[model samples]
Target chain A: MFPTPIARARPSVRTIYMFGLPVSLFIWLIPLLAVMLTSIRSAGDIAAGNYWGWPQGIFLVENYMAVFQNSPIAAFILNSFKVTIPTVIGAVALSCLTGFALGVYRFKANLLIFFMFVAGNFVPFQILMVPVRDLTLKMGMYDTVTGLVLFHIAFQTGFCTLFMRNFIRALPKALIEAARVEGVSELRIFWFIVLPLMRPAIAALAVLIFTFIWNDYFWATVLVQGEHAMPVTAGLYSLNGQWIASWHLVSAGSIVAALPPVAMFFLLQRHFIAGLTLGAVK
Target chain B: MADSIAGKSYWHQNQRRIAPWIFLAPGVFMFAVYVIIPIFQSMEISLYDWDGIGEKTFIGIENYIELLDDEAFYTSLINNLLWLLFYMLAVPAGLFMSLFLNQTVFGIRLVKSLFFFPFVISQVVVGLVFAWFYDPTFGLLALIFKTFGFQPLAVLADERYVTYGIIFAGLWPQTAYCMILYLTGLNAVDPEQIEAGRLDGAKGWRMLWHVVLPQLRPATFIAVVVTVIGALRSFDLVSIMTDGGPYGSSRVLAYYMYEQALSEYGFRMGYGAAIAVVLFVIMMVYISGFLWSMYRQEREGR
Candidate 1:
């Protein structure tokens, strides 16, 4: 509403603006639209240079089925879920405790510890890549889903702790003080009081981490090498290599790879945006 | 008995202090091991020579010295700078898009979400989509080039256009991300300021430049930080779209480090660690600045 509402504009200008909405959206989503369409097209259409035209016939079922039948993408999708879910749970749970400590306590190391998480979160993955991979290998978890999950949980805790601490800090301090005056044990206060208030922060962190771990490519390639453990990002890359010019299959695989995070974002749009824009708003 | 009773009383008095550490222990331990320790370990590794599997040889700064003379190193470094520059365009582009879409209208929520659609999907998908779109023969861009009486540019295969091409694909998602940040910022912009600007005849470009943009500082700061980070982390898209092909013209330091350390180029883990250390130093410059500012803000807020 910052640039005067459309309703206040002259009728003709308003009409033009309304007309432009879908037109501009069409242009914005053209690539995605193309992929969506191509995902449903027959290989024959692509081979015949019918890339932009309506498919001669819809082969949506066959194209999608072929992506699963002819590739390890299913296992990759499973691996993505297997890695992402645990990371979300682990990171969010760990941050809740750390965030509570940093947010509630007046400990001497509070800001020091909080800043460590903040700085660690911002370090480029390459710096962490070599040693993390080596440690995972040494732990006998290399190329296993467990290795990826543990590292992701550890790395994501940095950002999540930052978010969770800020959120917890904003909660009413009196509530904790009142509980303390009543002689409630610290753990009980956390479990029975602060934990309930942290639901929104936890939801936000969960959605954000789910998308992050799902869409992750760098660590997937660095830590996991086998067919059983490759997440969809790396799996899709391998499929791209194998499929060559078969756009339909590649498009189908890409759609499959993208679906979970997309679904999570749509389902948790409010929490997702809340988490992402924590510092953007005043 | 007296000592035991005193010990119990002492533990009771200190439980408040100890509880926080107990809460922090697991998260801190994991972070130190996986994230912080590796940063120093990689730095130390950079001073030696070793394949990932071989016995380590101490050759201090030799890799860094070799990097000084490597043409590919210079190419990736220059490309990263260009990426940093080109990628900043997302901030302005996002502001413009958010301004265009800020009005109240029917189906605006859907429009906003759709506008943000690209970002929700994986970059691998985005990279693949763009690579196909820029494909020489069957691609839409190629068709346009053909219709214009010019040979289609095989962007990924061409060294000159490859980095720009990949950066453009990257911008698709990045621009959307910035738009969301600004959109949220715009929602928090004061209506009173806009009303005052309008009453004083500040409209269009003047209104945006003088009245609107100052309020968007936080959004712009975040947009720039994320963009800088995104530009430096330009690995997935490059790996997916071009694989640093056409003789590795498209390699950013991240991709090149991976290539040097792990790729079929042979596992020069020490050299890769050196490249990582360089990237880490470059990042620490920005990271520390951001932290200092945020720390100041935190103290002031307290």
Candidate 2:
């Protein structure tokens, strides 16, 4: 509204907006651009104090290969998938059922349970740290990807349930009522009627949860100790310590660690935006 | 026949009773065990002194008393307050970015998504990027300083500038998040209302203040909620960038709790739990406000 439509604006103003867009984007992405450039820099370029200059040689592949072959980055990436995929599935499946129940039913404790999930979702992980770790140890799931996944699923359910319930509640109620009148069991109504209609919500939750879990470093460090089950987020930290002055290798590792979620956002751009901006548009 | 009908209707009425619990059971169980129960357990554990390896001994309020006098703890608390205050710059910055990017120019969508790249990546990566950027010797900032005839400032190494430095790194991604939220909010602004306001010469700043902002309230709420939560959960960046180093000057409650309980600093589980409890109490205030508004919405929708 402030700029008005492009065609209507004065030619000079239009020219300014067009040129300003890319310039602002360049400034906005300076750190990222610097990192991207660093990732491609030859070690010689770094030594020669060409930090912001054009790269003397492209070492992108060599740097990436170093991260994978020289370090445990490959294993870390596999571990991330192992933790993140199950979390997305388990958390989503649980929330669908819970969301259906809370969205459709009228009973005591309905709002109470809903708010419980809401509150649980916002709580800082520190409160659950020692106890959850102890519990994981007792269950003998400690230091395993499964241990990490289980906690992620359980914790993410709080947020997923909040999302799913709100999404389902916004659906028209008459459809469920009519299904009930047709002698469909409540379970059938949930399975046939509600679940099928929740595709968008499911997609949104999947992307959101994937990003959240993939980016999780705290729990990764707390629950798992060794490289055997370390996700890339934590792996990058270890790599960070090890690389020390090796800027190129560190940059490559950082890029590798950032790729999955970045790819996820790009591939699922629409759904990702929908998921992130869920409450914003309303 | 009437008695039979009454019994059947009663079952139908009570079916509603059965449905919610059935749906809620698994989620509630998981939430209770993993979240709700642990919160209380942590609170209880805070009353005792235990090295994660040893038998527990009752410490009562000693941990809190020590925390009261501990210089590190006070520094962490003040840094957290600084974080909360400085992190809020994301909202207006986000608003400005959203406004800047909210246009129909060609390739704008791709640019907007690319701008959001930081938020999607792990904070560990962001930390690394910033760490390198602020590196005293061949880093970008140092390079700039060299050209200007000034010695490089080691932001992470200098205790005076360290916390603020880490927070600046955090704001990069956080502002991107707020930008996307406001962009969406701007997209959904009522066109008719903007036009209506325009008829009365309500243009530019007046149009935004009167017509657009009221509609953007939901986005504003979410931005504040996520920002507050993000400010408090300042562990990953602190850990990745400095590990609360340059003499633990960058520690926040979240990081301090972990360091005290789990890290090489020694696992004072009870003391750590006490710190966690304090953080939990702080979070509860905001969580309650968010929940209260959500409850009102749910009731209204019902």
Q: Choose the strongest candidate by lDDT.
A: 1
Per-candidate local distance difference test: 0.92, 0.89
Local accuracy of candidate 1 as per-residue lDDT tens digits, B1-302: 99997998676678798999999999999999999999999999999998877799999999999999999998999999999999999999999999889988989988999999999999989999998999898899999999999999999999899999999999999999999999999999999999999999999989999988999999998999999999888899988888888899999999999999988999999999999988989988989988998999988998
Give the per-residue lDDT digits (tens) of candidate 2, residues B23-93: 78887888788899999999989999999767999989999998998888888889889999999999999
What are the candidates' individual DockQ scores? Answer: 0.84, 0.77
The share of true interface contacts that also appear in candidate 1 amounts to 0.81
Model 1 RMSD in angstroms: 1.3
TM-score, predicted candidate 2 vs. hidden true structure: 0.97
**A137 Cα displacement, candidate 1 (Å):** 1.0
Q: By summed lDDT, which 10 consecutive residues of candidate 2 chain A come out lowest?
A: A1-10
User: What's the lDDT for candidate 1?
Assistant: 0.92
Question: In candidate 2, which residue pairs get closer than 3 Å at backbone N, Cα or C atoms, i.e. clash?
Answer: none
